[model samples]
Target: MRIGMMVDSYKPYISGITNYVEINKQFLEKAGHDVFVFTFGDLDYKDDETNVIRSPGLPLADSGFYLSMRYSRQAKKILQTMDIVHVHHPFLSGRLALRYCRPAGIPIVFTNHSRYDLYAQAYLPMMPEEVTLGMLQAYMPPFCKAMDLVIAPSAGMGRVLRELKVENEIEIIPNGVDLASFQNASPTPREKYGYKSDDILIVYAGRIALEKNIPFLINAFTGIAGAVPNAKLLIIGGGVQQYEEEIRDYVAGKDGAKRIRMTGRIPYDELPAHLSMCDIFATASVTEVHPLSVIEAMGAGLPVMGIESVGVGDTVQDGVTGYLATNDAPSFTAKLTRLCLDSELRKRMGRAAREASKVYSIERATQRMLEQYERLLREPGRRKDKLYFRLREILQRSLR
Candidate 1:
C-alpha cells in the first residue's frame, strides 16, 4: 500500500506532529508499505528519511508553519496516486487533501492531534472567545463530515470535536512511542545534573508556552519547594522565544530559584536517558490531545502528577499511576507535595505506569493503525482507483 501523510510542515523544524509523521512512516515502511510524507515549505531541507515530498509556501514568522492554499502542481500529481492519505492538521493539509485526493477517490483519513481551540485562545487572545468558538463550530462539522475516516488521539479530544458539533464517527488511537529506548534506558548520572543520588527529581518536558500553563506550574512548585527539602524541578524542551523568556524571568523571580532548572531543548536521542534520571514526570498543560512526553515519561518508569483536564486526565491513572488534581496551583501543589514525600508510593506507581505504557509501543500502535488502514481498504464501498486519473494517462504533465 502507498500511504501519503499530509501535513502543513515538516523538519528541520521539530514538533510533536513532525515526530508523529516520522515515526509512523518508519513503522509503515518497515511493514512493507510505501509511505510518503506530503508537506509544505522546508523545500531545501535535506531529510535522512526517504519519500518526503515538499512544496513551497510562505513561512509564517518563526512558528515553523507555512501558509499555502494549494500543493505544488507536482505534489498534487503524486498525492492522487496514494492508495490512502492521512491528514494530521485540520486546516491547511485537511483542505488540500479534499481538493486533490477526494476527486481521485483516494480515501482520506484525518487525525485531530491538537487542542486548536485552546491554541486560538492562547495565540489570538485579543479575539473574543465567542467569535473563535463560533468560527470552529461553523468550520469543523462540515470539514470532519467530508473525511472517509476521522481519528482523535484521546477521548477528551473526541469530546472536544463533538462540542464543535462534528457528528462524524471518531476513532481513538494514540500516537506511538519508542518504548524500548525508555524502558531500558540508563540514567544520565544524577551528579552530572548537580543532584545527589538520593534527591527526588520532578520533571516537566514539553514546549514552554502560555497554553502549557507554565506560570501556574512554576508557582505551584515554589509554594511547595520549602516543604520538600530534597526535591528539585527539571524543565525540558523549548518553545516560542517571547513566552520562554517570560517563563525564565518568572522562575528567576520565584523563591528557591536553584531548585528549578531549565535545559532549553535537548537532542531527541538523549531524551530517554535524561527522562530515566528523574523520579516523577509532571505537567500542567491542558492543551494536549495525547501527550507523547507523558507517555515517554511513563516508558521511563516514572509516576506522573498532572491537572485533571482533557489529555493529561485521560493518560494518567490518577492516584494509581500518579495524582490528578484540579487545574489550580494550590490543588496541584498539594498533590506534588504528596508525591515528593512518598518514595515507596512513587516506586509503586512507576511500576504501574511502565506496564500501562506498553500498549502505546510503536510496534503495537503501528499494527493497530495498519489494521484500520486495511479495514478501510477492504470495505466493499471503498473506491481505490475507479475515479483516479493515473499519471500514465496524463502524458502532457510537466514531468518535474
Candidate 2:
C-alpha cells in the first residue's frame, strides 16, 4: 500500500512525532510498501531521507513549525495519489488532509499524539483554561468524526478525546521505539562525562520546554541531593531558546546545582548509549500522550521514575518496572531517592522494564498500524468519511 505521513514539520527538528514518522516510514518501506512524507515549509532545508514532499509555508520562528493553509501544487498532486494518509498533528496537517485527500476518496487516519489542553496552559498562559478547553471541544470532535479512523497512543489519551466529546471510535495503539539499537547497548564510559562508576545517574530524555516541567525534576533532585551525594540528574534534549535559558539559569543557582547536568540536544541515535550510561530514567511531565522517550529508556534497560498520570502511569507498571508517585516534589523525590539508594532493587526493576518495553517495539507497533490501515481500506465505502464528503458535496451543490 502507498502510505503518506502528514506532519507540520520534519528533519533538523527532532521531535517524538518526527521520530515516529521516520521510523514507521523506514519499516513500511522495508515491508515493500511505498511510504512518503507530506509536510509544510522547510523547502530549502536538505532532508537526509528520500520521498519527503515539502509544501511551502511560513516558518513559525525557531520552534521548527510551519504555518500554512494549503500545500504546494506538486505536494497536493502527490498526496492525492496515496492509498492512505496518516495525520500526526491535528490542527494543520489534519485539516489539510480533509481539504486535499477527502475529495480524492482517500482515507485519512489521525493520531492524537499531543495533550493540546496542557500545551495551551503551558504555552499560552494568558488564555483562560476554559476558553482553551471549549475551543478543543468544538474542534476535536468534528475533526475526529470527519476522519476515517482516529488513533490514540494510549488508553488515557483515548479517554481525553472522549472527554472532548469526540464520539468517533478511537483505536488505542502505543507508539513504537526502535529497540534493536538499545537491546545490548554498551554503556558510555562515565569518566568521559566526569562521573564515577558508583555515581547514580538519573536521565530524562526529551524536550526541556514548559510542558515538560523540567524545573520540577530539578527541584525534586535537590531534595534527594542531601541524602544521595552521588546521585546525578542528566537531562538530555533542548527546547525553545527562552525556556532553555530559563531552565539553565534556574539550575545554575541551585544549592547542589553541580549534581544536575543538562546535555542540550543530543543526536537521536546517540540516545541509546546515553540511556545505557544511566541507572534510572525520570520524567516529571504530566502532558505526555504516550511518551516514546520513556519506552526507549525502558528498552535500554533503565527503570523509570515518573508521575502517576496518563502516558507515564500506563507505561510504568508501578512496583514492577518502577515507582509511580503523585505529581509532587516530595512524593517523586522520595521514590527517586529509594531507587538511587537501593542498587539491587534498581537492577531487578530495570530487567523487568526491558522485558515490558518489548511490547512497544517498532516492528510490533508497525504491524498493528498496518493492520488498521488494511482494515480501513477493505471497509466498503468507508461510510463515516464518505458520508462527510457526500454531505459536503450536497451543500456545495445546493449553494450553486
Candidate 3:
C-alpha cells in the first residue's frame, strides 16, 4: 500500500506524536509498504526509504504547538497518488487531508494524539470555558464525522469524542515504543553522577511545565529524601526558564539539595541509558492522553510510579508492572519510598514492566494499524458503528 502519513511537525521538533510517526514509519516500510510523510519543518531522515513532503504557508507562530497551513494545489496532486491517507493529529494537516481525500474517494484515518480541549484551555486562558467548548463543538465534529475512522491513544480520549457527539467510527489504539532500542541499550553508571551503587535514583523525563504537575513530584521527592537521605532525583527534559528556576530554587531549599540533578533536554539516544541507570521512574501528571515517557521507562526495565489517571491506569497494573498513586504529595512520596527501599520489589516490577511493554511494541502497533487501513480500504461502505467492532477484533488479535 502507498500510505500518505500526515502530521503537523516532524524531525528536529521531538514529541510523542513525532516519535510515534518515525517508529511506525520504519516498521510500516519494513513490512513492505511505501510510506510518505506529509509534514512541516525540516525532516532529517534518509531519503531512500521514507519520503517526506514539506507543506507550504505554515504560520511562524503556530510552528511549535498548533499547525496553520494554507492548503496548496500541490496537496491535491499529492493526495491523488496515495492509496490511503493517515492523519496523526486533527489540526491543519488532517483538516486539509480530509478536505481533499473525501472528494477523491480516498480512505482517510485520523489519530487524535493530544487532548485538544485540555490544550485549548491551557493555551487560551483568556477564553471562557463555554466559549472554548462551543468553538470546539463547532469545529471538530464535522472534521471527525467526515473521517473513515478515528483512532484514539486511550479510551479516555475516545470518551471525550463521544461526549462531543462525534458520530464517526472510533478506535482505541495506544501509542507504542521501540522495544528493541530500550532493551538493547547499555545502562549508565550511577557513580558517574556522584552517586554510590547503592543510592536510590528516581528519574522523571518529559516537559517540566506547570500542567505536568512537576510541583507535586518535587514536593514528593523532598518527602522521600527525609526518609531516604541517599535518594537522588534526576530530572530530564526542558521547560521555560522561569519554571526551571522555580524548580531549581525549590530543590535547593530542600534538605538533600545536592542529590537533585537537572539535565535539560537530553537527546533520544541517551534516554535508554539514563532510564536504565534509575531504579524507579515517575510522573505526576494527570493530563496525558498516552505518555510515551512512562512506556519508554517501562521498556527500559524500570518500574514506574505515576498518578492513577485514565491512560496511566490502563498501562500500569498497580502492584504488577508499577505502582499508581493518588495525585497528591503524600501518595507519591509513599509509592516512591516503597520502590526506593525495596530492591527486590523494584527488580520484580521492572521485569514485569519489560514483559508488559512487549504488548505495545512498534512492530505490533504498525501491523494492527495496517490491518485497520486494509479493512477500511476493502469495505469502505461499512457502517460507522461497525468500525468500532472491527477495531476491537484487530486489537484482540494483536494482543494475542
TM for every model, in the order presented, reads 0.96, 0.95, 0.87
Question: What lDDT is reached at residue 347 by model 1?
Answer: 97
Query: Per-residue CA lDDT of candidate 2, range 124-194, in tens?
Result: 99999999999999999999999989999999999999989999988999989889999878888898799
Each model's lDDT comes to: 0.89, 0.91, 0.80
- Native-to-model Cα distance after best TM-score fit, residue 84 in candidate 2, in Å: 0.4
Q: Could you give me the TM-score of model 1 versus the true structure?
A: 0.96
For model 1, the superposed segments whose C-alpha errors exceed 4 Å read 381-388, 395-400
Q: Of the candidates shown, which would achieve the greatest TM-score relative to the real structure?
A: 1
Ranking by TM-score: 1, 2, 3
Which pairs in model 3 have colliding backbones? none
Question: Which sections of candidate 3 miss by over 4 Å?
Answer: 42-49, 57-67, 71-76, 239-255, 380-400
Task: Give residue 99's lDDT in candidate 1 (0 to 100).
Answer: 92
Any idea what lDDT model 2 has? 0.91
Error of 2 at 126 (Å): 1.9
* Deviation from native of the Cα of residue 14 in model 2, angstroms: 1.1
